[model samples]
Target: MPESATAAPPLQVSSETAPLRQVVVHTPGEEMALVAPGNKDELLFDDLLFVEEAREEHATLVRLFEAAIGDAGAEGGAVLQLSDLLREAFDGADARESFVEALVELLPERNFEAYEAELKALGPDALHRFALTGQAPFAVSATPLPNLLFTRDLSAVVGDHPILSLAATAARRPESAIIRTIYHHHPRFAAARERLIELPEDVTFEGGDLLVVNERVVMIGQSERTSLGGVLAVARALLDRTSVEHVLMVNLPKERYCMHLDTVFTFADDDTCVVFPPIIEEPRDHVLHIEAGAERGGDGPREFRMRPLPSVREALEEVTGRSYTFIPCGGADPIRQRREQWTDGANLFAVRPGLVVGYARNRATYEALARAGFHVVSADDFLGFYGDAAAASQDRIAVRLSGNELSRGRGGPRCMTMPLVRMRNSES
Candidate 1:
């Protein structure tokens, strides 16, 4: 008899080729309603209303992603769905049973058998609600996932490896489990041999605070969501896999607005970044860097480096081997910077080297982008360009989208987009 066939591994993304390629997204479902007006803050949400409308708007984004990738079913041009991935992982009865057992172990205090029964009883749509709201068929309290829209903050890919994130809050722990299951068992991703960087159970690491600057260097924020131990776990994991020269640990404010690194800063291009000067440039004096791997220690991990707030521009230059222009999130004005950063102004997503997607409400930020030689275009305009081969050839553009309602969810384009496969230089 022949041996059983195995699933293919997930495609590794190394560089940004076209503006955007292969993204993972989650369409809003029943779990979204768990964001009640009273407890919105607890979930890091600014406002709570219209889950259906949000789903509709998210659909537009899904369409946009499918169109940009060209062929929805192709490996390099696919939109991976969170729900679908979960369903795939839970396909086999044995897998489902094992996963439920693991989940019960993770949340030992909870009624495992009851929770498993509730999850099993739920239909496709209802499963989303049960997972998000945390309300089982029994008397369990509602624990809906109001922050699932900010998928970017849940997990991230560093170099050729993917890290299953451990969020700072207990509220988002379910999401971590969901992502871990998907990456571990999903047919497409299971083959990557991806390893999960396990942090101390109490330690937290949010994807929003972690940025993979390159294959060898990463920037992590020591903020409210990401603890020092969490950062160390990531550093050690990277070092174990390859020679990681330096892990720049940035200390950010523990305020609501400065919750994550992407909230205050994001790469606009391979050579440029958007930032809020107050946090990235003049951060409070409690920052440090740890050297890892062979060169730093004799065949072991080492940490003997510390630095004052490292300049974002300087770090980018060192990581990418190129000077970067810093575009203020809210332009040159201090007031605008604070105001816009509060609404995720700097959290722009790069589709290609010079092209990006951001909120249109941040007018000053777009103006700054224009001043820096980016051809600012609306999301509709970019989508139109994608429809027209003649216009798609144009370069150096920033696609703006109406993110008033979406931004209220506390994330911008980058938060909404989870890149799966970036085009290689040869392909581009």
Candidate 2:
């Protein structure tokens, strides 16, 4: 029998701080090695990564996640590599064809139509390798997808509905296409395929710009990577299809440093989030509230009412009926805040409420988290005590993972992971 026959459970991510059940990540591979100084800018990398160290750092993260979620025996642990899922999706003939066509469409400049048949005939492993490195046995070479390391930008699963991204730049277009194919073909996500929310080709939206505040509210950032149109498109779709009642759109500075929402903001607990003080505390970044209007029948346009909010904190409070604490990325230091936020200080991934993981280099950020009541611990230390009674008794943990090599890719923990299935607060 094929591997897809007994695929993992379907996806269900309703809140950012829920206990993570399953997630998708891509380890740095030859595609990352392909990124050199000369072509680094073109590949959307500020600096070329040392592939081996990056992989080691990412493995530490994977192990941390595995330890937190606990192993699930033969079905694999909580961490799922995007490449492995792609290979499994390729088990189906239809999935292979879909992937080939999507790749061909994504790279029309490559003129892949001529070799379409030959590409589809390749085995799953060969196809996976070709997709990553963009090198085929038949002498065909396309731009490698180095940005695949940041799985969070490809797609986001929000409350059982998968919102597929449309890459804003050509360099990351293949990453979007490949992930869309996985969501559509992977058996674990088969149920989501029916309710998948795909953005229009004319608009650009990366998953990193989105955050699920709760089952009824989602936050999207209109930044360098996600357009205003993309924000509205995703909002309208969520309002129409899912249980989401409010979509808070945050207009971010159109700069590389604030390219995605996760870069400046991420949830650390049910009522807390770490944020760049300049952006969230100051009134520079505008927050707009998009609420679902009266429901309409088939062929009728969905009604969505929009209004401006004082800030993200107010918006969440209004929607969730609860107060929230915004922990500064750097501990009360403006200079340190800028320096740490540049290295993705706010981009922490939550395993469960009060339990998060992020870059160890962000000392100021970790210090801020500690000041905010979180117990900061190194990845190694956390691993040492993990699964023990003492570890289980501790609360508000902030696990620091080494990210010196991985930070070159300009994405931290949240940006490197795409949570698929998560146990909701109520469920937990």
Most lDDT-accurate candidate? 2
**lDDT (CA) per prediction:** 0.69, 0.86
Model 2 Cα lDDT, one tens digit per residue, 1-428: 25544575767887998778888899989999988888888888999788899999999998888777764311445788888878888878888889889978877877888899999999888888888988778878577888998999999888888888899888888887788888888777766678889888789999999999889989999999999899999999998889898899998889999899999999999899999989887974399999987768888977888889898888889989999999999778899999999999999999888999999999999998888888999999988876543224438899999999999889999999998888753653
| Model 2: colliding residue pairs | none
User: What is candidate 1's lDDT per residue for 81-158, written digit by digit as tens?
Assistant: 676667656655544555565566556655665667756655544554456566655676446776777788767766
Candidate 1 collision pairs: 19-351, 19-352, 20-351, 132-144, 132-145, 133-143, 133-144
Error of 2 at 286 (Å): 0.8
What overall lDDT, based on C-alpha atoms, would model 1 receive against the true structure? 0.69
RMSD of each: 3.8, 2.1
Global fold similarity of model 1 (TM-score): 0.87
Distance from true location, Cα of 203 in model 2, Å: 1.1
Which stretches of model 1 miss by more than 4 angstroms? 1-9, 15-19, 71-77, 108-129, 284-287, 293-310, 388-394
